[model samples]
Target: MAETSITSPHIMQIVGYKNTGKSTLIAALTRSLTFAGRKVAVIKHDGHDHFEMDHEGTDSYSFAQAGADAVVVMSEKRTALIERQAIPLEDMIKYLSRYDWILIEGYKQAPYPKLVMVREEKDLSLMETLQDAVGIVSWLEHDKSESMKDSEGLVRHSVHEAEDIARWLVSLECHEEKRRL
Candidate 1:
């Protein structure tokens, strides 16, 4: 598979199968990173064929039904843009490149560094097939058992330790930044 080019200097992906807590981990990491004074942006891929961001009775929904290609809703506090199109992951990354960090929730095939979520021993098989896996966030009780041989050289963090995981991620980004310099 061809690697996805990442334009952002600081970006990481948290990827796993359904029910593996990728969303929860990303939320925690975003909170922790923002508290530490880092600007953070998040991009999540929805695997479903159809999803509705606006309710049927809402104005935005009405506009969409009226054949609007894009809808922009803005206020003093926040702004939302709904475009009727499929955006490539690389384009999204480039658009969000100004942030200090971008945490992506899926696109598992992308070549960016990722922390794979493992909820059971069977999930360990992912380690063997994925590229650029920097670490593992494990839900299994005994994450260090021999069953984890595939993750031997990668850092392991318990799923419950989001704060620690956030720290480790920041440190890894720092190390990579220095290496690039």
Candidate 2:
């Protein structure tokens, strides 16, 4: 099988501290992008340890015990997986290149265009830690703060302004497509 496959490739990532609405932002972005007739791929990094089998006695579980590094069990109805190994983010990105854009949840430190969700002053530094951060969506109001200012173009936006964000993201994608052409 091909390690990576794609057509037009662009990536946007959402990163933030726990419960800062990163998940909600991803959901909204997905909905808006889909509504606009764009195919989107998503990758989520889970920080937790261990995995559980939702289907305890399923064939996929048996293949996992038999030492399949990655098993993609597909049927007419659905699909499932049991895999091991640290799948590099780049590899995953390449695999999703077929989509118009890929939206990543977590992977805060990955070198990709990112939207950081922040709620407090302490979480502000994380924006710097992430690469290619284009903006921040915030729920807290910090008086006289420049947390979103940087050498790279930075946009400070309200989390509730979903339409604004969706428009901005669509514009960005349009610019990217033009550059490719």
TM-score of each: 0.90, 0.83
The digit string of per-residue lDDT tens for model 1 on 32-109 reads 988877788999989984877888989999999999999999999999899999989999888887787889998889
RMSDs, each prediction?
Answer: 5.1, 4.7
CA lDDT of 96 in candidate 2?
68
CA lDDT, candidate 2, residue 5? 19
- Candidate 1 lDDT score at position 46: 91
Query: How far in Å is the alpha carbon of 40 misplaced in model 1?
Result: 1.2
Across 104-144, the per-residue lDDT of candidate 2 in tens digits comes to 99888788888888888778888656778888888866564
Instruction: Report, for every candidate in turn, its global Cα lDDT versus the true structure.
Output: 0.83, 0.77
Among all candidates shown, the one with the greatest lDDT: 1
Error of 2 at 61 (Å): 1.4
